[model samples]
Target: MQKMPQWADVVLIPLISLILAALLSALVILAIGENPWAALKLMVEGSLGSTYAWGYTLYYTTNFIFTGLAVAIAIHARLFNIGGEGQAMLGGLGVALIALFIPWPHWSLALLGGAVGAALFGAAWALIPAWLQAKRGSHIVITTIMFNFIAAALLNYLLIGALKPSGSMEPATGRFPEATHLPTFQDMFSTAETALFRGAPVNVSFFVALLACVAVWALIWRTRLGYEIRAFGQSESAAKYAGISPTRIIVVTMLMSGGLAGMMAINNVMGEAERLVLNAVEGAGFIGIAVALMGRSHPFGVLLAALLFGFLYQGGAELALWTSIPRELIVVIQALVILFTGALDNMVRMPLEAMFLRLRPAPKPARKTEPAE
Candidate 1:
């Protein structure tokens, strides 16, 4: 018998965690001499109020979606692929190479090429760590984390030397070809008289993120490989007995995870910046961990969680801009949300499960057994 319904696990638990995070955040604001209700109002107004705001929120959402899916996939295989930061950096390098060198006649072709490059680069970065974990006794967590620094250093070297344009001091490559420029929301949605998403960074890559979600959903639920991944996650010994190879599952899952993380570059680099630059990821790679945790490693859940964090990000920026609250306050709020959803998840889940179990009606006592007749 289940302790609670599936719906409760998927929806109710996260919702409660979010509310608790919000309440505690409100208290924090009050302690800082700000009105909680007013602050909440401002956040809503800033993040969801206008098309301009929605553009920023959705832009952030797009990045988080890719990174969140990246993390969630590895999570299903019980692997902590925190090297998303490094993988994504390499992906950006790939994007830069393709966008700067390839003379694409159209943006669509460039976008496709950029995606392929990003995925390849990201997957390549993950390959070493995956191989180490699968073939050696090396721990994946430590290996992946160490790789992040390596990626950073490698990127720094290339940016300052090989990738930098001659006579230019900037550590980033020159602007991408004009044909590679993506159509932003304003370009796609504006009318003659009015503009939507004006000056916003959101672009067609958002659709790519959505497509990724659908693909991941199908991969996890409808594919044999996914079944093996989940089976391995559930019990390596049992999966081994069933003919599933742990080594194969780990390598494949990390590759997919790293590829997804790299895809984020198509949004931030090709779409928004129109060029690859250092720190282009803006910590979205790490935020993806919280997104995956809150979403419980489901694609749809990752989408919703990504949106929530996107809102918090844009809203927090607005809050800091207009109020006395410092920018770091948003970080505090994010940390609190992570604390409740990730670390303290059992605090909410256990209580809810017990309540639901108690609410279930007692089964009727078995009829008294008389002598067999």
Candidate 2:
């Protein structure tokens, strides 16, 4: 059999997977006595039909972009850093502390404090599992999964006891000071008629996410560290033979990956929420894995995939307002996309190979006298 064309895989695989997922979802919608067309129309209209919806979608996508990059970086090093949720939560804690305690006269200082605090906390969260994996040969998957539970417990304790606002019964910290709050786009959209629609709070986090994507692209495709990481992912044995230390690579990759997730904490605590609220991240860390997978672990690809998820989430939330379809149905769509992408990848390889072979020049007819002349 001939080899598959690389371009064919890049172009057709995702398209086919999306089409298949849509069809399957339509069937499922019918089974539940809902019109798929209506569901889809609602999704599109609610997500992209208005400026407010677009702004919200962008906000959500920014979170996904950072977290997805984190996962993608670890994946490139052959590590599955499933502790992104924990890392992000810890980072949020750090940002909250900074916002609460740091007396910054300037907004710039506050923003810097938040970024550094989140990065430090995230890196620390990742270090524990990295240490276990490197020193004791522990399985990262097991350790990271356990760490998520630990983080949740720790966060609940802190929010209820240490960080809870004085005069509030809710499981959340005090609102950030005015200096620490992210500037919103509300002022830019202000008009005479409807102030509610104008006061939408979108922040600079989206630009930060875009910059992170560029940095990740450079790190992965333009640096020696990235090459070594990719090498390890392709084959650890080969990487070892090539003198790349797996332990060091593993630890660094996890730290960098977790740091990116930590940035998501900034988007939450500093950019959007401006406070430490329970479940503030809203499962964005786990959703990041889906984004990374759908994007094939590429930085730019992850950005697009994250945007798609953001649209789905915003659209699904709006759909729930007027329809019987459960919001959880969006999660079902996400799962189907992942499953179909994997399955269709295998199915398409054969056809891609045939097409590549047909496009290649036919081998010169073997010399008739090759046997003995």
Candidate 3:
């Protein structure tokens, strides 16, 4: 028998699983007395049917890219950094405080201040759990999870008591000054015929996200620091033998991870909301875990996975407008993608191995006769 190809195992498995999931979801729609074809058509149309939809997709993609990179970085170090949500929230708070209180005559200065403030706050948040893990021998998963709650409480107190806009019952801070806000392409095209399209909220942050992707790819592939991180990830004992300090790597990994997450504050405070608000992170940090997993922790893969999720997020809302289907379906689909991708290694390996073994040549009868003799 001819040898089976290897790429089939790598690429085909994911493709088949996704197709199966879509078919299953369609069956579900049919069972619910809805037209599966219509629902599928609606899903596509809502996501990619127009420039407006594409713009929203890219907007959400920017946030997902940052958060996904944050999670992927930690995962590469073999750590489960569940505190991404908290880190992002604190980062937003940091940026908000700077933008609100600091008077900057130039937009460049304000933007830089906000980014730096967020990075510092996010680093601080991750440091707590990193310290617990390295010094106290606490499991990072548990420590990070607990820190999320603490962050929530801290944010609530600040939003309500300290940063609350005067006369507003909402748990939010005052809007940033116009000078501090990020500029978008839409601002220049305000009078164009495609004003609505031009007025869309896409901003320079998209380029920031792209730059981040390039930086992450370079860090992992070209830098000595990246080698150490990968070594630690593959085996702690081997890394230690190679003179890599596990504790230092752990701390550095968490810090870098949190710093990337901090950049998501740009999307929240600079692009979308223009201010800090309670629950502003809105679980993007957690969704990022799924994105990283779906992307198999590769930088470019993360970009593609993030865009897929972005489509689901923005399009799912538009889909709800035309169909009775709940927007929660998007969450369910996201969960399914993560579940499928997580099982991909096993799914690809086991079946291919079985097929290969079955196709192998049988042992010679002469060998059996010689053994008997």
Candidate 4:
């Protein structure tokens, strides 16, 4: 009954789009007077060359997974939660407060506390926008975007006046207690007498991101609340007729989205930086939008999309470092990928549908035996 095979829609389309993007990127490299093949070889060597590179790639991938899931879940509710940046900022505040004030005896306990604090703060930041949209009919996108700026300003004021440590000129808080330090991939692998992930920021939080992907998948596909959320997203009037409350779904969805975004701080702040700093998010929030879009809002799709962006991030840094290519070209490459995957998706999709249609066998005429019978 489908015009195109399911595999084509899910896998083939994305693969082809990626290939197109890569070809364009290669052309761009050639225009810059560099060998495209050599540039790509450098990217692969730098990003996947060794355990050290994998460490950074996975580290960045961990953050993307969290934020991408945040956007994906919200998309399921037909809500565009652009406030991930703001919610993540507030989550860092929560992590800082917990890691600084609480006397956790071990990193494990600190991680638990930090996750709770991050989720709570992230959800709290999203609450106002949810209420505004649910109760006052305000647009979620506008309200959430506005909240991002508000969050940044609020964080700035707090850091300068209250959070900043004495004798420190920076706007960041003091380092967390040593007990709060999360184990790096290096720390875990070194005990085996084999060095892997040495000097990389990838940490236990990568596993946490994986767990989150599994959890989100279960929540979306195997739960009654998820059914209602999807129903509400598909048709608000139909959901209302079925007695599902729009306000409730909207608020709950946003909270979950915000909570996921907030958890990114645990990886970057507690796991990697060991201290709360300004711009800890580093634009991962916006990148989540593209990830969610390209992944079709599926958890598994989001994971793969996150890894792809992670590769771009790590590889782009390497390109800038070793080649004459301006770092801005990397941004252009990313934009091209986003454009093909998200905005211009129909450009590829329509042709594929037509081809599939043409490839199908024609219907057979009725047999003459029917008339004889």
Which ten residues in a row are the worst by lDDT in model 2? Answer: 194-203
- Candidate 2: tens digits of C-alpha lDDT, residues 104-135: 78767887788889988988899989988877
RMSD per prediction, one decimal?
1.8, 2.8, 4.1, 1.8
Candidate 3 regions exceeding 4 Å error are 1-10, 188-191, 196-199, 343-345, 356-373
Winner by TM-score between candidate 3 and candidate 2: 2
- lDDT tens readout by residue for model 4, 1-373: 7998899999988888888888999899988799988888888888889999989889989888988999999999899998989998888999999999999999999998999999899999999999999999999999999999999999989888899999999999999999999999999887667799999999998999999999999999999999999999899999999999999999999999999999999999999998888888888887787778778789999999999888888888899999998767767777777799888999999999999999977564456457777
Best by TM-score: 1
TM-score of each: 0.96, 0.91, 0.89, 0.95
Clashing pairs in 4: none
lDDT of 2 at 151: 91
Name model 2 segments beyond 4 Å from true: 187-197, 342-344, 347-361, 364-373
Task: Give the alpha carbon lDDT tens digit for every residue of 125-195 in model 3.
Answer: 99978878877899999988898899999999999998998899989988888888677646643464665
Best by lDDT: 1
How displaced is residue 127 in candidate 4, in Å?
Answer: 1.7
How many clashing pairs per prediction, in order? Answer: 0, 0, 0, 0
* Distance from true location, Cα of 139 in model 4, Å: 1.6
Whole-model alpha-carbon lDDT for candidate 2 = 0.84
Candidate 2, RMSD to the unseen true structure: 2.8
